[model samples]
Target: MWYFLMSDAFTFGAFLISYGTIRFSVNHWADPNQVFNAFPFAGHANLPLAFVSLMTFILIFSSVTMVLAVHEGHKMNRKGVEKYMILTIIGGLAFLGCQAWEWTHMITGDHTVLVDGVLQTMGTTVTNNPWGVAADPGAITAALQKTPDANLAAIVHSLGHGGTADAHATLGRDQMISTIQAANLHVTTPGPIAFGGYFFGITGFHGFHVFSGVVINVIMYLKTKFGHFDQRGHYEMIEKAGLYWHFVDLVWVFVFLCFYLV
Candidate 1:
């Protein structure tokens, strides 16, 4: 297992290093703060890094619980092992739920804006997001110029200060959609498509590890409940599962830093 983890480490490290190289080489990379600002039930309030911080804490705390479970297993305490393992499973599930919501938001995007008292709809293609380099007026204006018409120009005029002028502007998702549409343009993905490809691939791989750890924990919890460990006169299965769980948690710390915080 250790050897497997070492190999996995190299795989993820290669992806992250590639992401870093591409990010610095590009004219624009999406700001992590702007991209991950949304929070549940916050009504679109900008709460950058808060939710991911919570996710990180949950995973780390579950690692703590996993340690406790292992310690209890050393004492052959079935109840303690079951309890901590269950907590660890809950933590894993919560993290998965958070990831699901995040992916949904990212893919669907913020694509509706009220324009002149009318709500408008826009969508994200593989090539667009306000968080990208599209916040440059010159780029959007130049793009619009290629398809010049009175209507597109009017859209550009409305998007004037809101679209590209304020690079760090926290416009509503809907308003951003409107601006992108009016500009008749698509912003490049943060840095290059490779950045996103690595970001999603590495994170998704970690998430899968978390999910598998949860399943292993659940089975161990059930075994404890059914007296399987008691018959064997040992709870070492819990300890083994705990090692994997801790590994998942440790990997997440690196992931959060590379993909979210940094």
Candidate 2:
């Protein structure tokens, strides 16, 4: 397990290094603060890195529980092992749930952008970036003139001016356009395509490791519950699993630093 983990660390290190290289080479990379400034159930409130911080806390806490489980295993305390393992599994699942919501939010989010003197809505994806540099005032004004009534209304609603979607949809086009022009609204011109690529790739890889760790913890929990480790006169299996779980947690710290913090 140690050898495997060391090799895995090398792989992750290479990915992060490459990501940094490309990020620095780019003239304009998306701002992490703006990109991650979102919280679940908080409409339009800018909370930078808040959700990811919660995920980091949960993973670190799970690592602590894993350590406790390992210590319990040393004393042949089956009940303690079961309890900590369950906690670890729950933490892993919670992290996965948070990640799922973040992914959905990013992919399905509606971002207004100026393209060819026309305003269009798009979301972040491997080939598209909606978090680019701010569009020029001239370009924005031109696009607004060419924007459809419904699109204009959507933009007004996104800025928190037109009420609920249902109510916002009933608003007149002239009123929607007037609301948008009165507000300090800014649209983007599309950022580097590699931004979304690396984001999904590296984060997805880390999430996979987290999911695998959760599965291993579940198996370990079952083994403890069934007396498998106790019958063997030792719980070395739990210790090995602990090594992997800890490694996963450590990798996340770097992942969070690379993708979210730095």
Candidate 3:
């Protein structure tokens, strides 16, 4: 049971990660600021919904508290166990609120913006659009097949033949953005199937983790409220909860690094 549930979760998160990678590889992709944001007043500020980043650190620290909780629970120090466990639940809840607010903002597309006498996109969907002299996915697939070693030269030739799919020419880059805008909502963006597939696929997977952890922590919180954990022996339940929480935070570290840092 654990294997199946966890394997599915892990696979989904990893796939979404790969999807994000392929999306960014597009020529002069959109920035995250224009794509997503915090609540109204905070939006004017340059904050990155960075609460999520702080949550990651809080979760890691909570794991340390969990270790203390477990140690105290084993020694039958009911007060210490309760104290740390309650604190851990609060941390998890704070993280959940951050994620919920983030989603509330993310699902809505970024409205169009006019800049420098040209339209430039800001949302993730921009990465998915394809318009104007679009590259043939089938041909791109064939090129991938034709490549000798998946090296730069082979890929460059593939893109060049298809008219600069890779980033290089500045004017062409602008045109491609305009093209994707024109192609917006009508066709999938250029490149292989993996490109569009991964964009939505990977992040959805990670979001699922955050969701599940919230549910589990809520359950733990209830049991604590009912005194289900105290005087009942070890707090392995909380320990296991902490393990999953830490794993979620650790993955976000990578997600933030790979998706945003670049």
Candidate 4:
């Protein structure tokens, strides 16, 4: 297990270091604040670090529950172990749900902006961004012109412009940029795609770890249900799982700092 952990650590370390190198090497990268300011049901409102912070809280609290389970294990308190383990599993699942929502929001690129009276959806691709310097005002306007008024108006209202789709359907280029920035949706002209790539890779890797930890915890819970741990005369399995869960939670702190807070 130690060897496996060391190998995995090396892998994550390499990925993170590479990300940092490329991110800093670039002249302009997307700001974490602008990139991750959306929250669930907030509709692109500026809730900087709020959702991720909640996720961090959930994982950290799960780590605490895991520790308590381990403590119960040391005491050979089967019921206590089972209870805390269940709590830990729930926390893990919640975190996964949050990640799913975040990924969906990112990929769907449903963010809309009025570019010359045309409502255009903002999205990210492997090589381009509709919200960055590469954004073509003409194309955006043309696309939005085809978009449904209901869709365009919803976005405009969300930005607090108070105009219905028909009332304020189009915006000048400068006004569009200003509206996006004012809503904390700022992006640079030459945004780095590498930043998005690395962000997804590292976070996805860490998320996989969390998922595995949850699976392991569930298996251990089932085993405990069957009296496996009590019959074994030790709950060392719980401790082992605890170590992995804690490591996962710890790694997320760094990931959060690098990809979100930084």
Candidate 5:
């Protein structure tokens, strides 16, 4: 396990180093603050890094529980090991849930951008970056001129208007276009295409590690429940599993720093 972890560390290190190189080479990269400034169930609230911080906390706490489980294993305390292992599994599952929501939010988000002298709505994806540099006032005005009435109305509705969908549907095209112009909604030029690739590749890789760790913990929990460790006269398996869990947590600290903080 130690050898495997060492090799894994080098892989992650190389990925991060390459990401940093590309990021610095670019004239404009997406701002983490603007990109991650969202919270679940909080409409349009700019809470940057809030959800990610919660995920970090949960993973770290799970590492603590894994340590406790290992300590108990040293003393052949089956019940203690079982309890801590269960907690660790729960934490891993919670982190996965949070990640799923974040991915869904990013992929499904409605962002307006100026493309080919016309305004179009898009979302973040491997080939698209919705969180690019904001378009200038002149560009926005020109794009608005070319924008279709239905697209204009969709943009206006995305700006959090209080009208019901039925009522909005009844409104005329001119009214919708006027509403959009009055609101002065900002659009962006697409960011570096590599940004989405790196973000998803690295974070998705880390999420897989977390998921693997959760599965290992679940198996460990079942083994403890069946008195497998007690029958063996030692709990080395639990200790080894704990080592893997801790390594997963440590890697996340760097992942969070690279993708979210730096």
Candidate 6:
């Protein structure tokens, strides 16, 4: 915190300045509501946004458990540490699971009650949806809309932004690059540089930290039971892990703000 507040003005300040500058610059950036428009089981729930929000909540809950685990460890309460540690593990695992589901839905695509925003037609397409609704050609056609021309350029353009009539709703080449990568993640996998840029850059890095914290807590759990820290002998491990856990949660909070909420 001190480093950011005073020490490295050029390094940290440069980053903060850059982020703010870009944010200010995107006057026509995609609308969060429109970009995340989705349809879930109940018929096109706003899911992407919902998942991000849920992930945020899950991380926060995990933080609570992590803190409790550390507090108990400090008091030399092995059983208490064990309990809170278990809760922390469960929360971490749950977050990972949710992230897995979120990534899966993105690549496969999803259907929604939305239809061109204004049209609101119940369109469906295998190429478009994560679920690939019933094989009704009408629904698929209304959504997929393959290019009329057989040329690569046509296909590319049709999918590319500002393409032809057949490709209006399609993602452009540059935008579509990450589509495939999104399908293969364990938790928010990297999808091309754009998707991967944020995926691996932010979430992946955060996950790595989580992985390390889990390792520490697991050690703490075992030693705790074996009498190494029984009766609250060694609470330092928990405190250290808590610090790392808090950092992880803190990063997610920022991620939710910059990547999702904002």
The model with the greatest lDDT is: 2
Q: Could you tell me every candidate's TM-score relative to the true structure?
A: 0.74, 0.93, 0.55, 0.78, 0.94, 0.59
User: Per-residue alpha-carbon lDDT of model 4 for 152-176, expressed as tens digits?
Assistant: 5555555655655455446643444
lDDT of 2 by residue, 173-231 (tens): 67777788887677889888999999999999999999999999999999999999888
Alpha carbon lDDT at 19, candidate 2: 92
Give one digit per residue, the lDDT tens place, for model 6 in 76-159.
Answer: 777898899888888887777766665554444422221331111111121232121123334423333332222222323323
Residue-pair clashes per candidate, as listed? Answer: 1, 0, 2, 5, 0, 12
Error of 3 at 64 (Å): 4.1
RMSD, each candidate, Å? 7.8, 1.8, 13.4, 5.3, 1.7, 11.8
Q: For model 4, what is the error of residue 57's alpha carbon versus the real structure, in angstroms, after optimal superposition?
A: 0.7
Per-candidate local distance difference test: 0.70, 0.89, 0.52, 0.77, 0.87, 0.53
Q: Write the per-residue lDDT of candidate 1 for residues 124-184, one digit (tens) a residue.
A: 3344333544335454434433432333433343443444423423454445445656555
lDDT of 3 by residue, 70-159 (tens): 677667666777687777667667666665656555434233222222232223342432222233445433333332231322223222
What's the best-to-worst order under lDDT?
Answer: 2, 5, 4, 1, 6, 3
lDDT of candidate 1 at residue 28, scale 0 to 100:
74
Displacement of the residue 87 alpha carbon in candidate 2, Å: 0.7
At residue 184, what lDDT does model 2 achieve? 62
The reply for model 4, stretches above 4 Å from the true place, is 111-120, 125-190
